[model samples]
Target: MNASTFTTRFRAAMMPTVPSPLAMLSHGKGARVWDVEGTEYLDFLGGIAVNALGHAHPVFTRAVSAQAERLAHISNYFASEPELALAERLTRLTGGDAVYFTNSGTEAIEAAVKLARRTGRPRILSLTGSFHGRTMGALSLTGKPVLQDPFRPLLPGVEQIAPTIAALEKALADDVAALVVEPIQGEAGVVDLPDGYLAAARELTSRHGALLILDEIQTGIGRTGDWFVYQAEGVLPPGAAPDAVALAKGLGGGFPIGALVGFGAAAQLLQPGQHGSTYGGNPLATAVAGAVLAEIEDAGLVANAALRGAELRAAIAGMASPLVAELSGRGLLIGVVLTRPVAKEIVAAAQERGLIVNAAAESRVRLAPPLIIGDAEVAEFTEKFAAALAAVAASTPTGATA
Candidate 1:
């Protein structure tokens, strides 16, 4: 269907909560998509960082195709082999005891949050500027109130703490259940907690009888230089791993999958029937996720993300354009914060020049190209991005706030 037709159908058939422009879609394939009019552009956004191997990878296409042919879904009434296999892979990757799959990252967070609260505690703490899914339970743990205000009286007993030992200590209480934080805050313009931040959080949470919940949905499964950023950071802090980790985004590659993993005693916290989902642990999604995991390992996409991401950051930082004030993030998730709020305009401009990027916030642009993106794509984006920024600069004052 054309973008306009789908857009019209969306207006008629779907909820009106999300913005209109976000509803438009046409077609997608590895790092590229075409609008309704058949306009082609590089897909650096990667379905908001969901495209692990990029669009239309033969393996992804074949995996989904084979699964659909074998069995599209089984309603979670029976155990699925593909799902179990995927779970085993995840458990191995996580170095954890048990795992529960979910339809999306928010649901994964919901499972984690509920498991934390089931401990008979009344309080849980998450960091500010974190974006968990929009479900009521997931939304409850989310720190952004603007997104949650419309649906009031959220899952209560949530307290937000800054990224500091002192703040975490102050928020910890006798009745606290868990503390949730993103290794690198993705939605908040890709802001990262400073070094040793996670290590310290683990220590304090342990000291206070609270569970440490690390949201790696955006940063896990080889999106960052590591399979799980917390795993890499765990060694830095010289301590044990986090109690629970929520992973999604790149886990399923382009398929819909998310996981909530718990280690040791925390793994036993989520007993059978305590939580479940219809579409979760299906053969299709898990098989695709397993394929993605295999690809990441076989192709070394994680190391690719690491080295290529460094090259990208260096290129962005090296650009003499006065618009670029700073650069941050690891792996393929790079954030280019401009001096002004011209992020949206820059993204639009990049698209016009045959590139795709995202304006994460008003002031920053987040580029999450597929992990398999190569030097060719990166080089093209580098030149085109410079041209786009120069175009913006030429049209406006040099030091004008973006």
Candidate 2:
């Protein structure tokens, strides 16, 4: 069956919340993917920033293949070498004392919230416009009222404040178990937090004895030009670090793996029976994650993400279209703000031209291209994106121009 036929049937059987299928993807290579009909498209979305090495990198393939042949699944009761090695590597990368692996981003957040609860402080603080996860516990910390209000009476004791030093200080004056913030807000249109804001969070959380949890699910693992966006010098005050971090999207490079990393005293909160995951760190997932990390390090993809991201952002902004108002975010995670509410139109036009983009909001188009994207890919995307913007402008009705 083709995409339309399967999509119709699938939607009938599955939840209605899933977006209409863009295409029945069949295979991929490098930074490109093909649908069942053999149409190729540049994968600018990168599975929503999950594919770190891009599609089908040799190293990723070899490592996953070898590990699959040996061992793929084992209960948490029996630890494997790959799982231990992966956890150790992640903790070292984040300067955390220990880690608890899970199966997805939301799971990582749940584990982190649980760790916060272990503090017995009775309250958690988050920033306005934050997007932690959709699970009940995480939904409590998510600041978007629309997403939270629908499921009212959410986990209580979760408060949200404006993402500023003054607001943070005011909130911290009260008893709190943890203060969670994303180094860069992804779902809220790739909003980058100010560096001093993060430093302030570290200082205040420390002062209040509240754990500082940086939700790096979208910005971690070289997506933001660094191993972790929090690692950017000057982003954190001297001798300061987050008490915990939630990681997932890019950690496994398309494999399903997530982690909750706890630093210093925060590491000792969880006991053996307090929390667990059945398939959280199975051998296959950890092996793939380990390979993903190795490829990122060996290929210098981190530096490449930085250089290419700057180039792409500059090129897009340089277009100077009246419809293109501005750009936000860093590295491969970018948000294009438009003068009009035509982001959905732009996304459709880009897809028609064999490019994938995301409409993060009515006027914001988000691009989280693979970290392995290069100069040629960036140039091609810029050309197509400009064309998409022009298409949207031409289709606009009179008096709708902004």
Candidate 3:
């Protein structure tokens, strides 16, 4: 069917919770995707940063096929080799003692919530402008009121504080169970926390005996040039570590998977009967995720992410578009600040010019191309994005603000 036909069908059948599909994508390769009508576009959003290895990489394909033929699901009642191996790999990467598998980032946050509750504390804290997830527990932790207002009466004792050391210091106490934060606020226009804020958080949480949970769902799996942003240099103080972490997004490289890694004491919080998932840790998902992570490590994609990210940022800055304000974020996760609140217009223009990106906010454009992106992809993106910026700048009125 044509893209328009599919869009109509999608809107008719789908709930109103989310907007209709932008286009009916047929397939993708490396860092590009094609719509059903055969229009090709450079994909910088990378399925919202879930397509770590890009679309249909040979490694991902082979692993899925092989694992499907061997085994897919055996339920949590029985263990599998892939499941065990992935668990071990995750622990090693995060320096955590245990892992709890889930189907999405929000589920991972829910697991973290239960862990905090296990501490017998009454309060759980999350930073303002943080986006955890959409589930009840996660939504409660999310600081955006627009998302939480409809789902009122959220999980109690969850409060949002400004992303500052002083705010955290004021909120943290013996009654506080955990403080959840994102290294870079992806939803809040890819905003970065204050310098040494994480180190200070670690010290303060430790003093109050509260768990410091890093929500690295969007930044994990080498998206930000490291396995997790917490591992990035200068993020945490020397010899300091978070009590737990929530991971997803790029973890399965486009497949659905999430995990909560608990370190040291936090590892023992969730008892066996406390949490479980029928599809969690299944062979197929875990096997595919294992393959994705393996390819990322073996191919040196982590280092590639670091290198490519810097190059991409330079290319964008070199354009010197008047509408371009500045850039934020590290590695492949980038945010382009615009002089005007024309991000949506830029996205539409870019899509028309065979490029795909998204607006993180009214004035901020988010770019999350695959780690495998190289010179050709960057050049293509630069050309199309420049055209997009020009198109929007021509149409937007002066002094536009969101």
lDDT of 2 by residue, 1-402 (tens): 687787988789889877878788889998999998888899899999999888998878998899999999989899999999998888778888898999999999999999999998898999999999999999999989999998999998899999888898888954799999998889988887765899888888888889999999999998888899889879998777899999999999999999999898888899989999999999999999998998888889889889998998888878888788788887889988888888888899999999999988888899998888887899899899889888878888635643
Per-model clash counts, in order, read: 4, 0, 0
Q: List residue ranges in candidate 1 displaced over 4 A.
A: 1-13, 22-25, 233-236, 398-402
Residue lDDT tens for model 1, 156-178: 78877776767876878768899
How does model 1 fare in lDDT? Answer: 0.84
lDDT (Cα, tens digit) per residue for candidate 3, span 1-402: 887799789989988878888899999888889988999999999989899999999999999999999999999999999999999999998899999999999999999999999999999999889999999999999999999999899999999999998998898899999999999999988888998899999999999999999999999999999888888898888777899999998999998999999999999998879999999989999999999999999999999999999988998898888899899998999999989988989999999999999999999999999999888998899899989998888887877654
Query: CA lDDT, every prediction?
Result: 0.84, 0.89, 0.92
Give the winner by lDDT. Answer: 3
Q: What would the TM-score be for candidate 2 when compared with the true structure? A: 0.97
Which pairs of residues collide in candidate 3? none
Candidate 1: lDDT of 397?
65
> Mind sharing the TM-score for model 3?
0.98
Kindly state the number of residue pairs that clash in model 2: 0
